[model samples]
Target chain A: MSDRSLSELGEQGLLPLLQAFCPAEQRGDDAAILTPPAGQQLVVSSDVLVEGIHFSEATTPPAAIGWRAAAANLSDLAAMGATPAGITLALALPSDRRLSWLQQIYQGLDRCLKQYDCPLIGGDLSRSPTATLAVTALGWVNPNRVIRRSTAQVGDWIMATGTHGLSRLGLGHLLGEWTLAEPLRDQAIAAHQAPKPRLDVVPLLARSQPAGTVWRVAGMDSSDGLADAVLQICRASQVGAVIEALPLPATTSFDRDRLIQAALYGGEDFELVLCLSPDWAQALLELLGEQAQVIGQITEKPVVQLRLSDRTEILSLDRGFQHFTTH
Target chain B: MSDRSLSELGEQGLLPLLQAFCPAEQRGDDAAILTPPAGQQLVVSSDVLVEGIHFSEATTPPAAIGWRAAAANLSDLAAMGATPAGITLALALPSDRRLSWLQQIYQGLDRCLKQYDCPLIGGDLSRSPTATLAVTALGWVNPNRVIRRSTAQVGDWIMATGTHGLSRLGLGHLLGEWTLAEPLRDQAIAAHQAPKPRLDVVPLLARSQPAGTVWRVAGMDSSDGLADAVLQICRASQVGAVIEALPLPATTSFDRDRLIQAALYGGEDFELVLCLSPDWAQALLELLGEQAQVIGQITEKPVVQLRLSDRTEILSLDRGFQHFTTH
Candidate 1:
């Protein structure tokens, strides 16, 4: 376990190898016995954002990389109505990369943590030939206000914070097919890069604490295409959804076809999905004000259909970035 | 965001890309809500055992790969006096490998989990050019008995559970130096392949739950070499130690010079370093008996020194396998 070079030793060698060198206190324990401040439950989640699978070679920036890592995890806590706490980044990259890029990456992470008010507690850094990053964000949840996707019921009006598809536009720009002006381009790019996690809105949602029984948050982040996200919600809640196409927050840069596609498929929106009943919608709106808009309704039909203004036309898309799917 | 492919998306895209796809419930909530029933305060630890790094190319078997992944993480839980619960694996592998090999890898993992009585909960699987496996094992720590390294006091007796250096012996066998019988060779190999995480012993120690004052099993695990581990403990507790080398388990497979190196530096002993008052040693033995042995006493000098039974031996060794020295 301890003798040979890594290439000669392989995975099995780690136990004995580590046993020889690692401190007994840190070594024997399952997890480090963190001396957290009095009364803090460990917050945790694991995310693997793959390269060539999730992003492209052309456009992602180092800071954006850093910001989004925290944002995705932070968003999860938000949906659960939990406060952002500590984070761990388990990153895998090629061994040959320069240290500057890594420092810049951390810089981006620092920016996000400061913005979200989350602390960078721990992380694991490793090298791989291909770039891959897995981060597990830990946060503490208030015992009462924990939001879950399973709590949403059939009658709740579905709502979302922020616009969809701007990230896709940024991606388009990266792909060279689209030309965008400065502010709009920056906005679109920011939607993809340095996307904000709604830590601010979670506590507010908790105060109103809209019907935890039926009218609740479900599914999660819009990183997948909107249609795919709706499908996930349906799968998790075991109900169908009828999303009104016109009500979706639209962007000016897209044509009708592209706009609808982005609404349906363009993702990385980092929006909140709130499902509430008719009477509670007003209460929720008052609590939330203009943070979001009513976009759809939950259904039992087990189908995700896009409803048109005509009421007769429905749109359906077959493909979006399913993690299991091969391109 | 969309359509740019993975490479163009780059490193800093973790947040947006992850936010884009992961379902809200699973993505970034404060902590993953494992809703069965929170009986024990959850103990969590993650180890990213990398390839061409932690292990060797020659000795790494699929079964060993699988086995060590579970064993390494479970050992930490055991160190905490925690019962192994659910385990999650995030695996990144090189493509173009056999499906059978992958299946065998799981077979090894399944063996450890089943034997240790922990269930496989959830996981993330993907491909990487370099083989990397990260395992997070969750266990339950007794609220009152959660042992920590910093809690070790000034006069604590340092002891180790089980013998050390067997893993190095097995590595020697694999390298064709250990001319042993098949059973002994297998034993060494198994030591490397599947570390016996002392779960049963941990709970027993917790139940015994010695004095309110003595060091409560501080500075656990044998990741780095024993001396390095001792150094870490001293640094954490802000003290020093004189290790009795005779009681420190030595092996026969290595030659005189090699034996000393292996015994002192060979990692992965998976032994517990208990910090107990000398008064409690007898009671601990009444409970743990001969499986435990007093090896040293904590000192105030803030320096770690080794004592040899023969001739107050002078040593010529400090450089050890530090996992990565290349960078």
Candidate 2:
């Protein structure tokens, strides 16, 4: 027969399997004890993923659901230039969910945490009407090197890591909205199913700054589309942005206009949008090579503008993906 | 007309309302930056509350739901003998939920956090089929004074803070399983709807030991039944327990047997069950006075026995509450 349902297994019966993913010493405690890195500030963030809203069981595998949840929180930490410390996951599962599905979710979460050199520290589990995953990630960063979204200055160059629109295209394909041929189709699906956080660029940014000088860079993860992220940074910093170009994935199969729309408003890209001094941006570009690209510049005018070859138009602030509202 | 729904307000529009409870400087960041206390280990725990399973709108008010969620996580920190640092709340609400209802929840959360001297740090908001709240609490504890459930020794006395079964009786009253009278009914309902974590006992336990001496106490919160908490400590410590008495509230409205059953098996008490050396137990008893009582002792027999005046019985291991299973 198949594995027992969660109701049959019970929460107590499920502890051993969950404990396998966490360190034994940290397991079996009311709260896990963590020692923060010496001389570093702790950075904490949380994100929630709901079935049908954030994802669908029809399109997202159980493991991918777990992976996406962890990645989302980790992306926030990466935006703050923090090194991961640990993760606390509170999961609400339907009583009828299979034990194998939960095990797969934990495996995916463990895979991501292992890659980031962090442990599944502590969490809670309960029965719910729908599957929900809330992940709280703890990380550490040097106080001097920590990044913020409110410090962008006029004349700073706007840059982004990785291409956009792939995840959106992947979701379209998953929903049967369109079809794509090999390689690109697989790439798009993988991008949607398992988005990677821009943690690798954090170290590169740290090294790009001089030893004694303070680092001042404004950054945010483009989880809610590239244009939305840039607009947010611009609003927070009391500055404006002129997007001269859109970062598109290297694919000729999709139309340019459609790809541009996806790039501007696709969401869930998990890439970093950064604003920094021109010299520092150049140094980071040199260090990151082709992994990063400059697409815009911070302006004195307090408005976001998309300046294409034919015309320039102001972007609406409300165009970003939002919960409870249809795209 | 009624206030706007979450779907109408959207996630961006909801930020300012959620930001009201957190510090302005810490708000609007991808992740909040926190400095750990000087020379202390961080204790982290998370808890989730789901509608219809953990609570019902028919019985629990919106503010109470928020209060209970924060209290549940705070109780876990208290079990580790830690001082509150901060709380991060991830909430998934039905899109149709009113803005006023969410405001009340935040108000209750703010009240709890203010009482504990912690701030609402960071979190995420999402849309779900049912209301779900996940709270992650961070606390700090002195390394030498940290408490663990696996440290119970065979000759230690088992004690608990506050009377048991009040919350259970309150829940019963709320569910209409039994009707309670006037003051008792109100008390029970309050206890059920807004349980308080025994954070005050943490300082008392810390001071119970002499200067420069390490703490050797095993502890856990009786969020699960008192008997279950005792059993967990025993199982982790590889010891047995003998319950010579049961802690009952000061009331004559209920029969002794029913009260005993409730005290032994009723969950959601939010009280502390602790095992310590006899001298330390006596010291804590003196410090706590009427707020605490001794009910049992650690044994080497590897079984839990309830020794009553008329008869003795061995308690079943599976009698405690387990999620995803019917009580």
Candidate 3:
């Protein structure tokens, strides 16, 4: 084994190693000035995905690893209603990993980014004992349609794009919270590995007219599930919410309480939490019929409650996700 | 000790980690989007400073750790002659470090950012086995004068901001390079620890207009030494360079060969490497007289050579930072 120091590994190991894939077009420039076909706003965000943390050593497939990495950043862009443009990957790998795994990650990122028309522009490569990835993605957004996390208001209706509890179910399967059979296991694993970030309704949501611009429900990506997203929307927009029991789209075969909890705190469901004025909700669903549905409504009160019955509202047992603390 | 897993970091950590000190007005938004104060265009760049390798675990103090982290990003802004604005710190700390030390890094960053009038805007923190800091600083540029790294042309003069070989020299001293006298050791330690990022030249250089636009001379921050930066400049701008043996500015007692080598490739100098028109050389110095000076000029051969004497020209070594290949 080489007794090379970290700084030496950092300086020497990373810079030259980066030449293997990092394009020479951006050698010494300050930042890769990504010019989208002009008239496009830049959608930018950063995420840190860690090993044995974001994924376990044995369970994380190389392709999945690569896909999820791009997925997380794309989700951020989708949260902003931005069209995926380009990405830069900063990876910290152990010295001993097979080069084939690295190639797989590249391939995975290439595939997803290509789907979004976002190219991997530039990145930094270095060695650390732990496997880590910090990805910064840039996307294009039209000014009128960019969504903010602070737009949801009291009296507005709440909505989630798709099923909520499945990803948590998927995670439950990953962390061994429950055992899943093959087709079942594959489905859960797929949910865990390749979350489809919603980018389809951005233009519609962005151009949703006066009510959409004024009292349109604000949004945040549901990495921590719809209920937790409820809390986040509540906190950011300064409004509480009452999610309807019958309307929530969730995973089948999930326990009621666990399903509620998963909807509240189970992570990585890349759905949008839209809080629209009750009057506008009907028109929105009519316009966005198949793409969205009203799942709840905003309340003036600060407590995030669930309405199982008119007089029997149940408060969430978990207010937020603490993946490290409880799980 | 709590056995919190990485996911427990949740969206934010469970334990109410000390909140970031971003201005209240800038916090809680989808992202911190700043409108440049009248007459300023935002300057932006990012950098990653890793741990266990950048500094010896022994001598890198908390304040220096924080200071260097901010300085690394600030240096990039300075090279572009941009006025610092705000920064986001993405920190991944080793699980073993004390919260108190983590706080001290904040202390160091606060001092540096405050000095540059750059406030902490926002950041993300996570857990890992080794510390790593990814810093992205926002700055203001004079729209007409944003410098780039690919503009250095043939016959342009090459200039650097400060002396070289000091950061690693200080590192060497801390790693027991020699039994240093107190004052000497202190200076070396300070250089290694809180290396100055020259932000004092942005307006001066803009006023100087050394070239058509301040952007005319391609430039970048010198993390590695002067020669290494020169090679990067040569490679990016597609040119070559020559240096007079006696014109290098270094400390009186510095070792000539080591000084040259470090100047060539001792990373993290955090200075500006500029390639400008020869006529702009004297004007550049007049503008940045006490701040930066004229170091050398650009050439056409696409090689870095040193002129030792009338009949002695030698091809310089391009081997200071070779990081990737190890057997």
Give TM-scores for every candidate, taking all chains together and pairing residue i with residue i.
0.81, 0.98, 0.86
lDDT of 1 by residue, A220-272 (tens): 65555567666666666788888884324444655667766766677677776
Best by DockQ: 2
Report the Cα RMSD per candidate. Answer: 7.4, 1.4, 4.6
Candidate 2 ranges with C-alpha deviation above 4 Å: B211-213
Q: What lDDT tens digits, residue by residue, belong to model 3 across residues B1-327?
A: 654444434535532453556777545544444444455554556666667656546779888888998998788787766778777776776654666677778889999988888878666666776677767666667656767777788888777776666676777777886444566566667878998887776666666664444457577777766666777778777888876642243455656676565556676778787777777666878877655666666788888877655533444334655443342
Instruction: Judging by lDDT, tell me the better candidate of 1 and 2.
Output: 2
| Candidate of highest TM-score | 2
Best by lDDT: 2
Better of 1 and 3 by TM-score: 3
- Model 2 C-alpha lDDT per residue in residues A1-327, reported as the tens digit of each score: 679999998888888878888898898889999998788888999888999988997789989988888888899999999989899999999999999999999988888878878889988889998899999999999898888999999999999999998999999999998897788899999999999998999999978875565689898999999988998899899999999987889888888888888888998999999998888999999998888899999999999999989658898758878886766
Give residue A161's lDDT in candidate 1 (0 to 100).
69
- In candidate 1 the C-alpha lDDT for residue B168 amounts to 73
lDDT of each: 0.63, 0.89, 0.68
